[model samples]
Target: MPKTLEGEIAADHAEHPTAANGAGATSVRHDRRTSVPRAAWLIGPALVAGVAYLDPGNVASNMTAGAQYGYLLVWVVVLGNVMAWLIQYLSAKLGIVTGRSLPEVLGGRIRSRWGRRAYWLQAELVAMATDLAEVIGGAVALNLLFGIPLIWGGLITGTVSIGLLVLQSRRGPRTFEFVIIGLLAIIAIGFTVGVFVAPPSPAGMLDGLVPRFADANSVLLAASILGATIMPHAIYAHSALSRDRFATRRGEQAGERGATGSGGAAPSGATGKIAWHGFGIRRGTDVAPELTPGTATAVPTDTLVRATKWDVTIAMAIAGTVNLCILLLAAVNLAGVEGTDSLEGAYAALGVALGPVIATLFAVGLLASGLASTSVGAYAGAEIMYGLLHVRVPLLLRRLVTLIPALAILALGFDPTTSLVLSQVVLSFGIPFALIPLVALTAKAGVLGRWKNHWATTAAGVAASVFLITLNGVLLWLVLTGA
Candidate 1:
């Protein structure tokens, strides 16, 4: 077996015609240089994945934290976001270096079929919980905005998500990314504008930054916030997103080379070039070369990894800011307010204290969060199933199947905000299952070659894992003991 990722790539390349022909050596070298997009163009994947952080689950958790605890859990949101930056970067790096997602890697590694099925069960459950939160949140948003019934609103949300998934399947990843990013912009504006209108007291905000929890309930909320901020599905989705963005198709490369007449520049839609709005962001038509069935792309691993860092950083910054803004908006305006415990309650409270416009924006943002996140959650669920079981279910079928749980809850008349918060807690329980594996795999030199995590990186990953697992343990103890 090949020892490192590059060795594996080289071994895979040995079978290709270009690698076999000595005359094609120069062409291969030129293709490697031209096929790698500049760092700036590699920005969308992480941002799209980052939307998972700003989902309605996040809005509910953060809003509840600030309203109930009055900034006590602010530290949790910040810490979670900081950890998310590292976790997401590692995920993106793994995909950029290895050309496989976390699930794909794990699926191949685990020897037992039962073990893989068991793992898939947990991941599927987590994905369902995610869908539940997103759908319920969307339902609540629609009800707040237009007085639509929760059941009907849920049906609408699920239908719209199917449409979004169709957009992703039909239009290609770039167009899908552009649409998600546009929704992300709307989410940012909708959530953050309220904070500027009624800024939290600086002293209170700083005090809230201190690491302390009031009680067992506080710990639960903290866990919910962390779960919402550092999502398991986002981790799974980011790796896949990065792999899709960077993976090069050899047939496309050869076709582009032939069509360009050898010496002429590749056209706007050539293999390496990613065109947006009728213009190419990168020079070449293709992005990178394929390594193997499940391995790294031909782009220089270091360059892609570096670009992934920027991508993850920018993504985390936006997600973290929007999350903080949500908490702060509630902290300043809704703390001690009776009706602010739920999203609808919060919306009504915001209108009472601020104005109708601010409340409307909050509802709009929540709607965007729900719509965007449910779509991404569906995508992640599909990837998870494909990676673990190697089964390819139609996206629409999966979306409809997943929507049943959320719609059922809404139909049963469960509190939307409570469901959202509890769903995040379920997500928190799932964090270690995804996170520990990611950390362990990325630390392995065999998996990532020289791009494997350095000792420091591994140590940080270990620390994060320990912290999260410990928190979950504490939460379990508290809940069981009725603390």
Candidate 2:
């Protein structure tokens, strides 16, 4: 079960500042010397966006967009990535600077009675919408693979995902990371093999990257592509991941003050009563009883910074390359190559061109992506709900909130083959709704302090937001007017 944002914040406050204990003092001192790697920061966006690339819904949407538009909408993915990079960077920077995640920060800052209520309402909407997509994507994959009824699949997925939530609570971070990484590897292998067997031409690929809006259908597809890429949960995930790293850095190293205090008593400045329920803190004074001229010191801050950067950079490189490869695979092999002109058509093409086995592999990749992306979405929903309302709803309940819509879709007996594609479009429509707060938070120096966005970053972020809003609006108008 996930704790409410208030509950989490309260728990955090109850924690005794590591600075107070002797080990805390040492950690603070060590923090001063530890330097983060230059590359660590780059991982922030990849962690938020990479798995999303694998998202079943995104795969469906991108494939469909490619088939319908014949590579012309490749610009949408490129543009979405550009926007994702800017927004996620802002989220990471904000989390690092404030020592707070997006939801937590917003909870503290938005104090108006009606305004707060409205924010919570909107957040809940985003959560439900995002989760709905995940549930549908998973169900679609199951239907594709085993011929399970879509409704049955949705119910099963909801149950299994809840179990995963419980397991996550007990599992350590390293173990969880390994699981996600392994899944990513399997999906990557599947997609790469499919691409290698039936590659697209380089010339057509070049043509796909250029922007064109020749018709209403093309524009809608473009909007859907962009909307699906920069999802709402991702905005929240970016902040939370940054906070996790920040907390780890703070815990292992030292306080912000110049004092050397890693393992020690809580600092007086820090307001918390951390009970040693499951975790332990080392005393800072034990590092060296007396400062000896010959003693070896802990690593410097620059090194910690560099290490952080390195970690982020490696993650980014791996995630970005995988994403680009997946996009290429679709653009070359599946995009209007045959009479097929939709995502399902692309899969049909894969079956014909590569084989049934390859098509099955694609389905597996979609399944993996759906499950992975949804896990993050669940966490993000819990965070937002807690942040605004301070209620600790169980993970199963959150999953249910998302699962209902997918289940409904199943009852309709609709072809789930297209569910993945539609889910991305749904996400695209929801992006601007969630991103507005994120951009506002990052731009305010008061919220971020020294971590405020630079002019270039701010410009890019604002521009992305404006573009998304306008594009979504235009698409919506076209849909409503039946133009």
Candidate 3:
């Protein structure tokens, strides 16, 4: 596929800093420079990746999980988080080793034009499905908070989220992370109140953390949890985030004379740039500097990978804790309540038990969840679109396009809860498509050199991928047969 113009610009701005001699091209140098301690590299991409786990999809899915099963499916959330950790790590590793995202690498590897086109089509569908959950979550949050109807609430969500994106463009990813992390804190506070107000039996909740579903519906819901938790788009987004944030600057001085990486040259107009920072007040250096001139630090590939792993683990662990908290609160307060499968039902039930003031806290959390996740999903979509199709659209235009499916769902009068659940299931299906490629690329000695996946690491990743695919397929079968 040809690179889009914005893709070329992003590339020029990102990859060519030292290598292009002012012309934009990817510059790779394999010499030692400066290495930072693992602790020093802890703050950027991994924190951003964790935001995917805390989105409104997770809120909705966990709400259902806790209310229906009363902590019985807490194990599923745990499982989902574990899967997310593995998948995200592998995705990020692919980016560091090859300095390209899983989707971009697929663009190079798929070979046949038709095959690549087919991949793009499916990936686009996945992105839209992703947006569906996020948009609905935000809209539902608005409805809950202000008593608006779902339709108008959705429009409001769209407007506010776009405004936030424009703000994020100006503020930079660090600001975006702070905003997301702050929203996550709101969710945690909401749950903290619920856990104290309606604490479940500790022993019982612990038992619930073991992997057993109460029935077939639990199985179907488990898939939704995986979709919301593991998150297909997150895998692609993490790889790109890590690659761009921590790429090496080794031997950059030599590149000042105009040299390119062994990946070689692109045809004219093929040098696509992604206008990721187009709306930002700061230059690319002020945002992600590893890609810009004189900004990246040199380190051994293995050390960089090691530091990244620790970073991913800590951020993802916090995310997993948040998912668990969401499930725990629902189980304590709304589990088994009649008609509590949806967010509103749960809210009403809580209002009855805890009174309106405390119940309103639920809406506050939901609004935060919705707002953060909606912005994130749009950004993830932009990342995938650029990586796969090498195209760039205005941020609002990108946000608007992703909103189409969400609007259609509302127009056709789809049940918001059911639509959210189904959207997660759709995300589950996209996992293997992303994971299989990550495993293959990471295991290639030529691609990663010494940083390639060891046999044990490759085996683990492949096993996890197979297990995820099998479980997703089983969930699909159960849903099809209405089991």
Report the number of clashing residue pairs per model: 11, 78, 10
Per-residue alpha-carbon lDDT of model 3 for 266-348, expressed as tens digits? Answer: 32322223223322122222212113222222333444566677778987888888788778878887876888888778789
Number of the top lDDT candidate: 1
Best-to-worst ranking by TM-score: 1, 3, 2
Runs in model 1 deviating more than 4 A are 1-37, 248-295
Candidate with more favorable, higher TM-score: 2 or 3 = 3
- Candidate 2 residues lying further than 4 Å off, grouped into runs, are 1-49, 245-328, 335-345, 417-419
After superposing candidate 3 on the true structure, give the runs of residues whose Cα lies further than 4 Å from its correct spot.
Answer: 1-41, 247-303
lDDT of 1 by residue, 1-483 (tens): 443334434543674556333223223432232123355555789999999999999999999999998878888989999999999999988877666678978988999999999999999999999999999999999999999999999999999998887777666677889999999999999999999888788898899889999988899999999999889999998988887766443333343344432433334444533222110122343333323322235544555676678889999999999999999999999999998889989999999998999999999999999999999998899889977887778666788899999999999988889999999999999999999999999998788866788999999999999999999999999999989
